[model samples]
Target: MEMSLQSMQLQLQFFMHKADDLHSCLVNGQGHVERDALAAAVVSFLYTCQPYFNHLESTVRSTRPQHTSLALNIYTQLLDIYQQLCDKLEQLVLSCASYNLLCLEETEPNSVSHFCVGQCQLGQLKLTTFLYCKPTPYLSQVDTRLYKRMRWNVEKLQVGQKTDKDQGGESKEREAKTEYYFLCYEDIPNTHAETDWGRPGFSDGNVVRMWSIGQWVQVDPDPITETIDDWILCDVPQANYNKLLFLGIEEPSCCIATDYMQQLLLLWKSADSW
Candidate 1:
């Protein structure tokens, strides 16, 4: 069966409608809209993946000799997109937890710092993140810069983990000045946000750290002249929910469809070599 882009778009829209209907009228939950939104996002991902999936199926069904390289490229890109789609979906879910969460009207310095006041806990989304610092300033000491960069690295990740680089590669010959970003801790979801967990990566109700590349995350209990917790960029010159994200820097959040899905994709790639 041939599935063209237009056909897939229709398919995606249909699924979204079906999901939205189920979400609004059929399903019952406090976060059903968020759930429905995620369902639609999953459909969106399939829409993007459909083209490559169709090509893969066609190659299998056709009698003509298949171009192995062409198939591999499409497959690799499909997997990458699938991964990216999951990451976006997770961010949506995490953020949606804050939806209808009583927008903070006070927008005052003292009010924003209190989670219960201007912020709320997201226990289910299970995000592990670091506090990112402001953009490179007039500049500073090496250790400070390195630590800042480590947090930055954690924030830059969208999806994927650090796998050891090829040993034979020239990785060991790196310049002396570079600061190594380390993975501080792996976060475990408590399922309950009633209390603030301590140590490793938990503090002030939320402080989970996972890094990739050189990106900075602000430290917990922000080290500033004054103590405040809301995104500073959001507070300065006044902030609304819409402007907070844009004003503050964004970092990557890694979430895969599932560990098994990752393994399946790898297996599919290995199968292609034969």
Candidate 2:
């Protein structure tokens, strides 16, 4: 029996959830250095694994016999790597010595910093990120950028068939209601994209994905900026019912958005009623 892509993705999701649990465990642990290292490793593993699985799934879905062997090879490699990561995570969890989190350093009482707004390509999504900065290790150095903040668009999607009649005619037409979203991630140097994500043996400067976010935003241009302002920050009709949520910059968030879109798409496709 051939395994379905959905089944394969389910297994991958399980592995990802395990990785998430490991990250949470590390977050509560005392070993700052070790915890951060292991957390980073787990995130790195996830970032590397997804694009390969996506490629394999696409190939399998294409039903090209010539690519079956190649897809299977990739699937096997993914499973092997997954096992290795699971082992490493388990070992780290077992060896962790729990301790209360401590404040490593104290800051000046009157220090204050304002949020800096910036825009960048975040995993194919052109979104703004708010930065919280703090002084660098050197007293005379500029502040380091910390905690990239982004909005996760979530909307209560609706799908339904509409009834309409031709003028003075009994004819009827039926159409399927489906929406599509595309995201493009531009490659930047000195980033993890070198070996972490993207095609297996290809180096494309841009990665495009078919994705949709919750509650689409109608971004009208501001009178002065000409440049489209932050859509999430704007007050729109959906703002009351489907406000965008925020997440701090983290490696896991990369896959999390894709996974969310997958689930939402599945729901939209599978729903029979509004």
Error of 1 at 53 (Å): 13
User: Could you tell me which 10 consecutive residues in candidate 2 have the lowest summed lDDT?
Assistant: 130-139
Best by lDDT: 2
lDDT tens string, model 1, 165-230? Answer: 675333222222111122122233433444434334434555333222322223422535434444
CA lDDT of 28 in candidate 2?
61
Question: How close is each model in CA RMSD to the real structure?
Answer: 20.3, 20.7
- Candidate 2 local lDDT, 22-55, one digit each (tens): 6576666565687656645644554454554444
* Model 1 TM: 0.22
Q: List candidate 1 segments past 4 Å from native.
A: 1-67, 100-274
User: Candidate 2 at 67: error in angstroms?
Assistant: 21
